[model samples]
Target: MSEPSLQHPLTGKRILVTQADAFMGPVLCEVLEEQGATVIASREDIADPDAPRRIVDQAGSVDILVANLAVPAPSSRVGDVSAGEWRDTFATMVDPLPRLMQAVLPGMREQGHGRVLVMGSASALRGMKRASTYSAARGAQMAWTQSVGVELAPENIQVNLIAQNFVDNPTYFPPEIQENPRFQERLKREVPLGRLVSAREDAQFAAYLCSDAASCFVGQVFPVCGGWVNR
Candidate 1:
């Protein structure tokens, strides 16, 4: 069957997406633009101290903010993890998310409308053997997203988390993980669909959640796991 044409229910809206250089980020930007929304794509690493200011300077008025940058954790046991490694992982995966949201919240409040999509991982729901730090950070992100969503609901600024499964995008998976045969077999066996989720599929859902159609969904962690969690 021919694919359906991309359509945006949020046409004419202004959207800002961080980590635009990432695979999913660009896909989202293109989809939003095709749907009639004015998209401001930023390649900023939100973990950087100066990133928030740079994004604000570039996208003057952001009606939607998608925080989608994450640093992969180095494989190590809890006891063997170094202090610097822990700090770096926390900064990249946990910090900056709230800071970025704070930068855009005032303007959204003024307009009485906004949508914040925070990308998390399915690993947060299920523990991975060597990914303790990464899982913890994602769990924290989901909790933070919920709190912010509740706080901003009165102002019509909805915040939600997308807990993604093993998406079949190079950017989503670290090269080292992809190179591991045992991990690959585990993923194939665990995921009910027997395959990785597609970037386009996740992007499509994100586009909808950021639209008026999903106005009622707030502070919720929506899973796009392809039945991985169930197994």
Candidate 2:
């Protein structure tokens, strides 16, 4: 492993963070930059089949790829889940992933070292009401990560994901939800941690995963759900 600066775990690393303005993108980019990495932030929606390849081409060679893909969770009941809705969910969250991986691998393979971290959800790690579509999509993300992470392991490309929920983010748990009494009670009762994990806390963990120190953790799904999924 290379000697990294204690104050800058990612110093000299070039990282590409997709969906730069959403999910954990902003905070993730901030943390990576603070750790001295060159962050190419992309705010484009990758639902288009061609977008992933185009985005990866635009970013060129990066030491790390932060696939911060996300979309609003569908609240449609299982019985009423439309074909359009289900296809759209996978199109938005699952389809473009392989393109991005395929596009980035050639460069990573040449360099002999790279990292890919998916800022995914824990909804798939556990069950939830009215979240069948969301959970399935997230499950596909983790499953793909496992397969690709292993396939690319010998090439020195580490792939892993953070299966997270109950984290303080505008997307999943907004301020309004946090302020609601019922939601607060639910948080207290459901999450063993009894609170939402801060966005910074999650991003900090992501930074470590992108660093040289975390090279040994290939294809693993690290849960960061404050124990909500355990229940």
Candidate 3:
């Protein structure tokens, strides 16, 4: 089948997307390019020690910044979690968002206009059983994005988040979980949509959030959950 086209409202804009090789990231890139936006792709693991420098080198100034890198926590009861696991999860999902935001803000402020979209999960809305770390980190990201949005609004920069639901992207589900029929059945029952959200749909929402049309949508955690969170 032919690849789907990206129709973006970001014409002539410069967009920087982190974790470009990941499923949603590439789709977003394609869409932005289709809309005439110049996209610079970066794959620095945001949790890595040199992530800031790496991202800066690849992206000097951007009209839009999409922070889309995250590490999903393993599903386990709270009592069964280990320190290292918790640290790793936080490193990817929570810690680096602020740092990356700092790195991008100076240029954005100088320009007096910018758009920032931080990717989050619908899991943050309702805590899932055996997903303590994931819930905590995603929740933190949502809050931080809102705080930044408020702080940056006076400068004409918009900051928001997309609290996505059960997307069908491969990265959304770990291999073992995808291979488990029992778990899959349970997921089907839990999501009222009766299926997972598509990556393209999520990407399209993201692209819109980064466009001029979303200028008034600051500090909001918009859901693209396909009715999952509403239930």
TM-score, every prediction: 0.90, 0.96, 0.89
Q: How would the candidate models be sorted by lDDT, starting from the highest?
A: 2, 1, 3
Model 1 CA deviation exceeding 4 Å by range: 1-6, 174-184, 229-231
TM-score of 3: 0.89
**Model 3, stretches more than 4 Å misplaced?**
1-8, 174-184, 229-231
Candidate 3: C-alpha lDDT: 0.79
List model 3 lDDT by residue over 53-83, tens digit each: 6696568878888888677558979998889
The clash count of every prediction, one per candidate, is 0, 0, 0
Better of 1 and 3 by TM-score: 1
Q: Is candidate 1 or candidate 2 better by lDDT?
A: 2
> Best to worst by TM-score, what's the order?
2, 1, 3
The best candidate by lDDT is 2
Error of 3 at 107 (Å): 0.9
Q: After superposition, how far is residue 216 of candidate 3 from its true place, in Å?
A: 0.3
Per-residue lDDT, model 1, residue 69, is 68
Error of 1 at 169 (Å): 1.9
| CA shift of 66, model 2, Å | 0.4
